[model samples]
Target: MTLAGTLRPQYDCVVVGAGVLGLFTAHHLAQRLDPRRILVLDRGYLSAGASGRNGGGVRQQWEATATIRLAREAVAVYRRFPREFGYNPWFRQGGYLFLAFSEEEAGRLRKVSGVVRSEGLPVRWLEPHAIQRRVPALSTEGLVGATYLSSDGVIFPFPVLWGLYQDLRRRGVEVRTRTEVLGLSREGPQWSVGTSRGTVRTARVLNAAGGWSRDLSALAGLAVPNTPTRHEILATEPVKPFLDPMVVTLRRGLYLSQSMRGEIIGGFSLEHPGEGTSTMPSSSLFLREMSAQMARLFPPLASLRVLRSWAGFYDETPDGFPILGEDPRAPGFFHGNGFGGHGFMLAPAAAPRLASLLLGERTDLDDRLFGPGRFLGTKAARPVEGLTLG
Candidate 1:
């Protein structure tokens, strides 16, 4: 829905997408510049995209140092969000457990756990007995060991998005939902953005449109190597809260967590034909596979009924990391997409860091790590294969 403010012909900055990234980016921009000069445009209602469709998982466990740091900072912000914004995101520090069933998987976890520990995070290597003790419902057959991060947790995403949206509105930032960006072009020093509603001219534009980011970048004559893949998730009927921590099977790329409302919320990736973006009717394949995996892992959940299932797109990059920073060809355009499956978790820190970069402020995160320039190189084309554990 459009706000009461008059639509300006031009703005200092126009942020595309009203998801968590866009909302947080606009909020941070308001803090750095005049709030009235910033405008946020979304194709659909706020939180209608992947931001609201995720499984509400957050974790600081990552093999990359840059991602680990960003996640740590993001979790800290999530912990304080409820008190600071007067909105309960239902933040739960139930921890994240990554199970390794094979020697190869165990080795990978060991190596990554080293990096996690080096970053000063509390990560533990749990034996099968310890793993079984922690989650008695899980089957330990062929399970080598697991990595547990006590501080990693989950938070309800919609409240966080709503909180930011309300805060930005109160700070004078104009947020317009159902405003789709049709085209983007550089006109002298400013950008002329053609939208479904109307054309807007802005000195800078932040492309935070998630899965639609590749198309948005193409509109500016920039070809990004990001692909949108459908990821499916489901929730079961509310049962007694038995699962405290989110569990991930590293081998199968499966994960599940019992929410505060007692519904088991989770998803997993199966070998698809690498299909392009299509978030539609949930697949029976995903439901069957996920159910089988869940039942095998946690036998007690075998009889539980699934309430509903839905699909969302993952803006995946070759390196399994997000592409951030400004477009080299388009001077005023910036990127905040290709987050693979961890965009929601990284939003808290990534948005502010992106805003800092946009406003020319010093940031702790080095832009080179997430820069789009990496994709042009031979070494960066190699995929880091692993399921995002959160």
Candidate 2:
């Protein structure tokens, strides 16, 4: 690794975006190559995007086999973080409980239970009474059944970001914040990345721009099938610990869990899709609908004061899976932007695999399902179902 000597005309690799995915990828790149040759650029503060604002629920309750595999590996990486990186991310293994209010949802959970169990993950189908047994405070009056994955839980996203950022800085990785990529062009075999700050030349460039990924792809003269939608979350004032596991209701498109400080932090899906960049207050409709649903789910928290609320956009792909791996036409370029809503949970594990691919090392994991070319006539190997909105 060498020192940053002004803005060089060439670099081994240039990673766009300094979010969790970008920093982790840059860290892995630094590990495999000279850190001096790697430059990480972001348009905003570290983890300022969805990576930081999202409710950090880490679980393997995915419908698709591929997503389940990725999540399985990701949660393992998150669990081992304290020992592996000497940073306690505060991962709570309180588990995740998916409550199904309607019979249709319950049936779906039954099928998903088979899928996860087939993968050797400890997901079991539970009756409403069983759901009550796990989290007594939950209102299961209308619920038919639920799915419980005892190993699933939550972690603090900022701590994880700090840990990874420290590693990148120690490895001499140059991270430029508030530096947005203005444009990108392919000059023969190398890529030229023009940024709001300055121009960067690198042999390879990775797009991990989160919500702005599509625009970045267009800037690079490529078409990426992705959309950014706004998701909102609100935290209530601290109260005595009541619920134990993270509760999710697919039929209602709501998820809730208690933070370490005993504040109930959660959110629900909105029908209106959000577009463009705007961190405005959560809509009145969200406040009304989400609050109503939260009250129904946990009647005990009906009196909890709403502390505050904010919204962030998620880079959702066509099939609800991320577009990973190198682009065929855009040579020496890669996509790690679309994790839908699962980017943070998938970061710790996805980084090492992406690094191996960039370093030309062998990997057993098949990232082809997440390739950009999949939208270009390639049939996706897996499909998404079940209640997943993290």
Candidate 3:
């Protein structure tokens, strides 16, 4: 499984970044194109980026129509991963409960629930008492109401990445790790991708670099509006299985869910101190904020010892949605970054659509919503607020 052999000088398509999105795109491309013609390159090892550092939460509940549809389809793909790829990601369907502590927040949740239900998703309005019934550990003192979607849940990310990587290798797709894409230049119809290892001439290049996608796009002389920000998460020591559904507090931007190993794993959005892409170090500020919020919601968790803390970058966009489709400035360049925090959940559905576009096939999902041209004033940008879920 080593890429020690002499590298091919050319490829039909060179996918940058071997994260879930890039791997899945390569997987789907193998179905239509020759596997040998497709290549995946990453700056680090597989799943070493945001793809491996996430909480693995998957949900269909979204504020935007396109995002909701994408999530629903992704959940289906996640459920079939074990059988399709021979790797179980431990996809749990315990559901997601968004808690609201104020009337304004509850109203927004109700509106979103209505929209989600109208779109044929199984969502229900939960009063404070009903929410308390589902999780007796939660404090309902100031909770106004909540929205529950039973189908939304979580999955183990490592197994998914491993499954995709193994399957891609089995299909003869070249996946080279630690191969940083240094520069991209267009010579006629081919794209010259300069890497740390060597130069690869590719017909098309897909920017799936996650947090570093914007920087990768810049190498091609393309300016994308995506910003990479650091997000932190921590886990507690394994305890008894008590929390069933992933709980999200909309007010404080806190979300938590118990893993299969019985550890409470989650994170919260804080007033980030640093600007732009800086050091991704976990702050005591996050720990203090998370602890206070968790204790307020669930008092017993205060006693549980925090195992460890880590931070990862989130490729955020102004619209808080992903940037997809081929770049207008760079002919053979495609953008698939700016997923914010939901890239892992949306990758399954997004990858196929992106591949379809690359292969010139009619895709079911609307590609325009995520196209990079929107920020260029070619299309209107419909920003999805209150959907990042941190």
Q: Rank the candidates by lDDT, best first.
A: 3, 1, 2
Best-to-worst ranking by TM-score: 3, 1, 2
Better of 2 and 3 by lDDT: 3
| Candidate 3 per-residue C-alpha lDDT over 144-247 given as tens digits, one digit per residue, 9 for 90 to 100 | 98899999998999999999999999999999997889999999989999988889898899999998988898899888898888889999999999988999
- lDDT of candidate 3 at residue 329, scale 0 to 100: 84
Regions more than 4 Å wrong, model 3: 1-3, 273-278, 378-385
Root-mean-square deviation per candidate: 1.8, 2.4, 1.5
Q: What is the TM-score of each candidate against the true structure?
A: 0.96, 0.94, 0.97
Which sections of candidate 1 miss by over 4 Å?
1-6, 377-390
TM-score of structure candidate 3: 0.97
Q: Please provide, for model 1 over 226-298, each residue's C-alpha lDDT reduced to its tens digit, 9 standing for 90 to 100.
A: 8887778999999987888989877657888988889999898765565655444588999998999899888
Off by over 4 Å in 2: 1-6, 278-280, 378-382, 385-387
Candidate 2 lDDT over 160-222, as tens digits, reads 888887788887888877777898999898898887766878878888889888888899888
Indicate which candidate wins on lDDT.
3
